[model samples]
Target chain A: MTDCKLCSLEEYLKLIEHEEITYAQPHKPAIPGHVLMIPKQHVAIIEQIPDEEFGKMMVQANKVSMALFESLQAQGTNIIIQNGISAGQKDPHVCVHVIPRREEDGLNFLWVPKTLNEEEMSTIELRIKENLTVQLKPKEVEPPKPEKVTDDYLLKQLHRIP
Target chain B: MADMSPEQVEELKEKLKNMSPEELREFQKKQCIFCHIVAGRAQAKKVYEDEHCIGILDINPANPGHVLLLPKEHYAIMPQIPDKEIMHLGITAKKLSHALLRALHADGTNIFIANGVVAGQKAQHFMIHIIPRKEHDEVGIDIPEKLLSKQQLQQVKQHILPSIAKSLGARLQEQPVAVEQVSPKEQSAVPAPRHEPREVVIEDTPRKAQPKAPKKEHPKKDQTKDEDVTLDDIADLLGGS
Candidate 1:
C-alpha cells in the first residue's frame, strides 16, 4: 500500500479526476496523449474490482477512446495491459494504457513472439472460446457444381450412380 | 457548457490565476460524458455489467465485438485504482477477450488502454478496450522489436525485478507467485491463486486513507510532457519503483 502510486494519484498531475476512477497523464508515455485510467482504491489488479465499479471503468475507458478518435482526430489506437512481469506490468496497481495510434507510431512493447502449433491452437481455441460474445458459427462451404457437364454427361453419371 | 453564472464565471476567473491542475482535473471529470453513462444520465450499447464495471460495444471499433469496459464510479486514470479492482478488471477482460474471439471467430484478441494523452487517450474517463483481431485486420499495433544486449538486459532485470516484487505486498511475498514460471495455459486454468495479492494490507491502509480532499492543496509541478516516453522506459521505471 505504501508503494502504490495509483492510490496516491492526488499527489500527482491528474488529467482527469473523478470520485472513484482517475485518468492521469502518465509521467512516461508510449504515444502522444497517452494516459492511464485507474481506480481510487489500492487493490493491485482488475479482478479484485467490484463488478459495478468495473462497469464504470469500462465506460470511462471507451469514452476516452471515442474522444481520442473524435476530439483528437487520432487515426488509430492501441489499448494494452501487461499483467505479470513477463507481461510487462511495471507496478502492482493496475493501470490501463490508452495509446492513441497513427500508422507511423512505430510502436513496440518488448513483445516476444510465440508460435502456436496446430494442437496448441486447437487447445487454445477450446479453452478461450467459452461464453462467446458472438455465437453464430460460420456456414460450411458448398461443393462446386460441374457446370460444363451437359445433360448427356449427367445421364451417364446417373447410370454410374445406380 | 461550463454552466457557471456571470458572477461565478468571474469567481472562476479569479480562481483560475491560482487554480491548480488538480482543480482543473476535478472540473473535467464533473463534465465527463462517461460519468453521465455511469450515473444513468447517458445511453450506451452496454454488453456486460456486474458490481464493479460495465462493458459496452465501441462506437468506433477496430473490429466487430469490440468492448469498452469501465468502472461504475469515475476515476480519471489507471494508477489510482486499487489492486483488487484492477485485478478484477483484468480477469473480466480475459474472460471477455476469450468470448470475443469465440463469438467473432477471430484469429486473435487484444486488450489494451491509452493511459495518457500522449498514449492517445481522448476522454478523461478510464476504460479498457477488448478488440478481436484477425489476420490483416491492420489495427497497426505491430511494434518493432529492439533486441537488447545481454548486459543491458541484465541491468534492466537487476533494476526492475525488485520493484515488481515489492508490489506483491506481504501475501504474494509469502507465497511467491513466480510469473515467469507460469505458462499461459496453466495461468488461465485457475487464475485466482495466481492473481490473489495481499488485500488486507492494501484494503486497510491506503483504501481507508484514499484522498478526496479539495485540489487547491498540492502544487502541480509535473511538466505536461509531450515527449515519447517509450513503454520500455516506463517499464523500467516501474520495475525500479
Candidate 2:
C-alpha cells in the first residue's frame, strides 16, 4: 500500500477534502479543467469496495462536476470512467474524467472505424444485453470458522450438559 | 488509433499472462502520472478535492475547463467496478457537469467513456471525461448513423431483452432509480480511508448551485434547459447524437 501512490495522493494534490472522496487536478491532463475523484481507501477494483462507499464515490464525482460548472465558465461536460486495461485504463487507480467542452475545441477522441456487419452488431448487442441483465448480489456473510467457534464444539457442549 | 496491430495484441496478451493483478497494479502505479502527482513527485493544475476523489485540469482538452475525476484506490476498469462504486461515480460526474455549467457558463456538457482500447481509450486508469458543449462544436463524438435497421434493431432488442431483465433487474423493469442529487448526510457511514487524495482544481471564484444556462452557447444547451438535466440527458445525448 505504501508503494501505491494512489494511497497517498492527498498531500500532493491540493484536494478539497470531503466525508468520502477527494477532488483534485490531474498532473498531465488531456484538457484544461481536468480533475480526479479518488476514494479515501486503497481499493483496486469497484467490486471489491463496499456498496455504500462506492455510492459515496459517485456522489463525490457528481459534486465535483457541479462545482466545475458553478465556478468556471463551462459549456458542456463529459464524465468518463475507463474500467480495465483492455478498456484503456492507464493507471491502476480509478479516475473519472469530467471534461469541459466549448464550440470547436478540436480534441478528437474518435477511434478508427471498424464497421460491424449486421450479424456482428446483433451479436454484440445481445452480449451487452445479456451481461447487463445480471444483477450484483449482496455478498453472503461468512459464518465463523470451525476452528474459531464450530457447530461441533457447540454440539459437544450440549452433550456434556446432558 | 484504438486498433492495435496483431503484434501489439499478442504482446499485450503475453504481458497479461505474466502479470499478476498486484504486479500490474504496481506497474501502473510506477508509471501513473496521477499517482506521482498524488505522491508529490509531480505537479498539477488543480481544480478541487474532497475525501473520496480529486478534480483537476486537463492539460490537453477538447474544450477549456475539462476535468478528470479519479478514485484514490487503484481500480483497473468499469466492468471490474462494483455496482455501488459505479453509482457513486455516476452521481459525481453529474454534479461536475453541473459545476462546469455554473462556473464557466458553458452551453452543454457531454460525459464520455471509452471502455476499451478499441473504443479510443488510452489510459490504463479509469477516467470520466466531463466536457462542455456549444452548438456545432468541432469536437465530434462521431457515432455513426444507425448500425442496424428497424427490423434488425428489433431482433437485437428481442435477443437481449431477457438477459437485460435478468441482469439489470429493477431499474430496467421499472422506473429508473434516481441516483443523482444526493445531499451529504444521506450518504452512508464510511470508515477512515487509506488513500490520500492529490491534485486540486481551484475555483477562481466559487458559485452557488444555479440552473441558469451558459452564456457562450445560446438558446439553452439542451431544448429542455429550464428543466433539471437528469442522468437521462446524457443517455439521450449519446443515443440521439
User: Taking the tens digit of each residue's C-alpha lDDT, what string does model 1 give over B17-63?
Assistant: 77688886667667798877877788866666779998776655655
TM-score of each prediction = 0.43, 0.41
Candidate 2 lDDT score relative to the true structure: 0.49
lDDT of 1: 0.54
Per-residue lDDT over A12-77 for candidate 1, one digit per residue giving the tens place of the 0 to 100 score: 335544556666555445543455777777766554666567655655565555555542345555
Best by DockQ: 1
Per-prediction DockQ, in order? Answer: 0.06, 0.05
Q: Which stretches of candidate 2 lie over 4 Å from their true place?
A: A1-162, B1-16, B170-241
- Candidate 1 stretches with Cα past 4 Å from truth are A1-162, B1-26, B170-241
TM-score of chain B in each prediction: 0.59, 0.60
Give one digit per residue, the lDDT tens place, for model 2 in B26-53: 8788877877765668875545455655
Error of 1 at A162 (Å): 85
